[model samples]
Target: MMRPHRGLDPGSVWAQRLRQLEQRLRTKEERIVVLETENALLHLKLAEYQGLAGRSTNEVLQLYAAHGQQMKLQRSSAVTQLHGAIKRLKQDLKSLRSFALELSKDFQRQSKTCLYQVLAAVQGIQLQNEAMQMFQIKAFDLEQCLQEVTERYEKEKQKRKALHNNLIELRGNIRVHCRIRPLLPFDDSAGHSVSQDRRRNFSEKVAYAADDETVLVKCSRPGHASVNKTFQFERVYNDLESQDAVFADVAPLLTSLLDGYNVCIMAYGQTGSGKTYTMLGPQFDGNLAFSIEEESELGIIPRATQEVFRLISEKPPGSYWVEVSVVEVYNNEIFDLLAKDSYGKVFGIKRDVVTTREGKSDVPLLTHETVENASEFLHLVNKGLQLRVTHPTLVHAHSSRSHLVVTLTITTVVFGDNFGTSWEDEQTSQRLNKEASCTFPQKMRDSKSTSSSRASSPVQLEATEKMKQVKTRLQLVDLAGSECVGMSGVTGAALRETSFINRSLSALADVLGAIAEQRSHVPYRNSKLTHLLQDSVGGDAKLLVMLCISPGQKYLTESLQSLGFGTRARQVQRGQVKKKTFPVPSKGK
Candidate 1:
């Protein structure tokens, strides 16, 4: 497996190696000749070095002798200088010893002062440490208390959810929040354009907020017995309370609509008692325009719309949809203010309301305008408000002849999912008013059955029920102010309008009385107003009756009546509050 290269043979390799050796021998001989020449040069240099070395030794001896003499002279001079320096150093040492002794005495005195100060500082630091320890102990206790509170809150989370953001009045009861409207100058038979002094003299305030939950009505005449009645409500706002303060209590209910509860907030008051001002803002004048400054004066409606949309904005995209229906109960007949003509113009359409099988009142074929934001909702509301029936009466210059009911219908959907009815308590009283049942499914069945000419499979109906959208209603009712005919000085149609308003309000009162009495047959159909509000009052809906009161002696009688109505509403024990949820549909459909 091994092979020699082309020039390779043992003999040739040996001859090549010998030639290389001969070349190396010639190079060695040349090197030896160079070495011999170098040796001769080195011998000459060594002889020269010996002669130079001898001369250098002699010169070194001469230099050493000369240096020894100079050293002796320098040593003598250095010894003399050392003696002088030693004497001076001895004297300087003595002076330094005395100065150090003086410094030691001063240091001892200064150290005494410094030591006392240091001790005081140490004492102060010790006190501070003790205070710090006490503070730490207190902080620990507070932390423990906070932790306990958190635990308690976690334990009661369910019960608290019924409250829904500490709105305690929402607990299955009609919360009566009394608002004592301030005594404006226009509260007299004369126009409101008067001097400040005249306005003050005309105050004659009989009704006022006594406290946060009490309304005081004190009326004293020289010839009559004094009357002072104190009534308790959920919240009582003074005449001085701002619109924001009044709505703060109401704002909580708006969000509950999204949580699956039908919420109704009604303003109950007499004519010219600031009911409209409390429900809406101040009346629009010529331009129907207001500034951002007036935004503070906006009442529950605009603000509530804003808050609802704001809450909706926080939800998932397209999770919730809002539709608005503006209805006015005029002349005991309901008119849809938001109704649109075929020409795309809005006008009042006389609409009829019927009770749902679930005992909830709903208008059939009513116009519900879907709104995107607060501005659109308010635009629609403004358009509807323009169609409201108003007449210049002796009592109110701009008296609303009809009850304006603005309902915001909130519809939300979840595909292929079930809405839980866990909030429906098992021990809930059977005697309770018609609860807002799991009715979206009922609605689906009603729809499926009504559309049923042909037979469909169970799976199809189930899909329909699942795909059904659940909606809740937020009913904001601004009732027509109750007024006396003789005092109002009305004639002709004014009298007729007054008669209808009084009758509808009386019918509302009668319904409340029936509910309070727990009568078997509630006369909800007696009046359009009553029939329309049947579900809100009788059903498990959040009903907040904001009783607006005039703070002047002029309106004392009407205020008392309104206050009594609110009291009766509060007394209506219709059982616990429940959500109008979409329960699982029955299979019978």
Candidate 2:
């Protein structure tokens, strides 16, 4: 390959060398272009493979992310379910605990019941035995002794009541009790109170129970000297006192009724001063029966009724019976509330009060209802109260329009055989009064001996056919309020009622005033109310005046007026209460 280019002409050889070098350079360039074309194809294929792998990786990553999210949601749901289950389990556990506690108590009660039953059975078996027979006899003896003790206790109680009445007679004073009512809702009159704060500051209380037997009244006004007055009373009940407490002090007077003495209990006060509330229990709708819860809150009338029946029960069977007469003195006219029509419907009937042969006032042909038990008695009274005149006024929503008088007449039958030998009870009254030698203990012995004799002797039993009847009355009077005309805000018919009420109250005051002044000419006939209350007001009867008052300064004038009335009443000089007896007609007559 070297010899062909070496032997050519010297200039020509250089040209040939140039041509060969050009051909070699062209071949190397063509080879480089082919290699570049293959490399471009390889680059295109590599990019295609890279694009496919990248798309697959992206799909795998998305699926992995979705699976991870699904796992997270499942774990969260499991945790939430666990928590909910725990909460439900906790609630169930609490409920189960309570149930378990109640069940345990129930089981204990059942166990106690079973034990009691077993003991009762065992006691029954023991009682059938001979040794227990002796014990039973001893128990009977003990029971008999207990009964005697109870009888003695009842006698002592009656004696104590008698002593109390005697003491009152000796003192020449009437029992006057003042009761201060708490601030009622209506006390804050809408016309007076501008705001809640002002209500408290407007009228401070002016009257208060200073002690058990004294009332302190403070009269204060703007830019004036306060006038303080103190009044004495037989008893003073504060705003906090319960109805039971008020009745406790008044309960002893009821015993006098069975002792053949008249017991007059009068409730006097201004309108909205709790007179009705003190006389009848709260919410005294008159027609409805009393509820069990309201039993404890019963006022004077209901309690007195119950007391009358209780005392009657202690007497000999069929010895005493009660008859009730209810009358309301309205506009100075008496209306019988227990009057019945042909259809047996009760209504108010106008009646006239006539004077009896003994100068005692009596309502002729007034409706009288005989009751066997306290419930029947209360039912009759409630029926009468329905016919009672009541009107609403500015001072009170249910103001009494008339004076109510509920008289319970207790008829006590005395066997004449008791007067035959040694007994002094309703027997040998003339001798007992002349000698004054027989005492309560002596009377008790005599009654026992007479009872034993009656049990043994047919002669004394036959002599029991002749009996003596004595009737004593228990009068419960609820007086209408002596309120001011302007304060009552009444118009037309109510105004007339107000006038009548005021005049009647004034007449009562006059009677009291006359008695206090020892005037020979008492004005009892001046008003029907005075005439009706003749025996109890100034005669020989136990008179108790309950003065209900409001502590607010707004009712100061009325309070003072009532206080004056009560003071005049206390100063009256009534003689000792005397026993009343009526002769019974023969069986044929």
RMSD in angstroms, all models?
Answer: 24.5, 31.9
Clashing pairs in 2: none
Best by TM-score: 2
Measured by lDDT, the strongest candidate is: 2
Cα deviation of 18, candidate 1, in Å: 99
Tens digit of lDDT per residue, candidate 2, span 1-589? 1222444443444346556655655665565566556556655655664565466456545655777776556555654664565566556556655655665566566556545655554554566465768889999999999999999998997797567656777755578899999887777773443576555543568889998789999987668999899998778999999999999988878886777777899999998888888998887654336677787778899888888888877765555657778889999999988887889788999988777787877667777666767787777888888888889987888999999999887766554555323333544444333333221123322321121112211111123344456567788999999999887889999999999999999999999988888888999888899999998898877899999998887788999999888888888777666766544443343
Prediction 2 global C-alpha lDDT? 0.74
Q: Which ten residues in a row have the lowest lDDT in candidate 2?
A: 449-458
Query: Deviation in angstroms for 265 in model 2?
Result: 0.4
Measured on C-alpha atoms, candidate 1 has an lDDT of 0.73
Compared with the true structure, all predictions reach lDDT values of: 0.73, 0.74
**Colliding pairs, model 1:** 438-583
Off by over 4 Å in 2: 1-166, 190-202, 285-292, 416-465, 581-589
Q: Estimate each model's TM-score.
A: 0.63, 0.64
**Per-residue CA lDDT of candidate 1, range 1-589, in tens?**
1122455553344345445645655665565566556555655655565565555455545654677766556555654664565556556555555655665565566556545555555565578679989999999999999999999987786575445423534435677889988777567653346566654544678887887889999977658998899998878999888988988888878777877888999998888888889988886321224687787788888888889999888765444667778889999999988776789788998988887677677788677666778887888888889999999876678999999999887765543344444222332212111221232234333321111111111123343444434568899999999987865778899899999999999999999999888899899999999999988888877899999888786666788899999999988877777765664243465
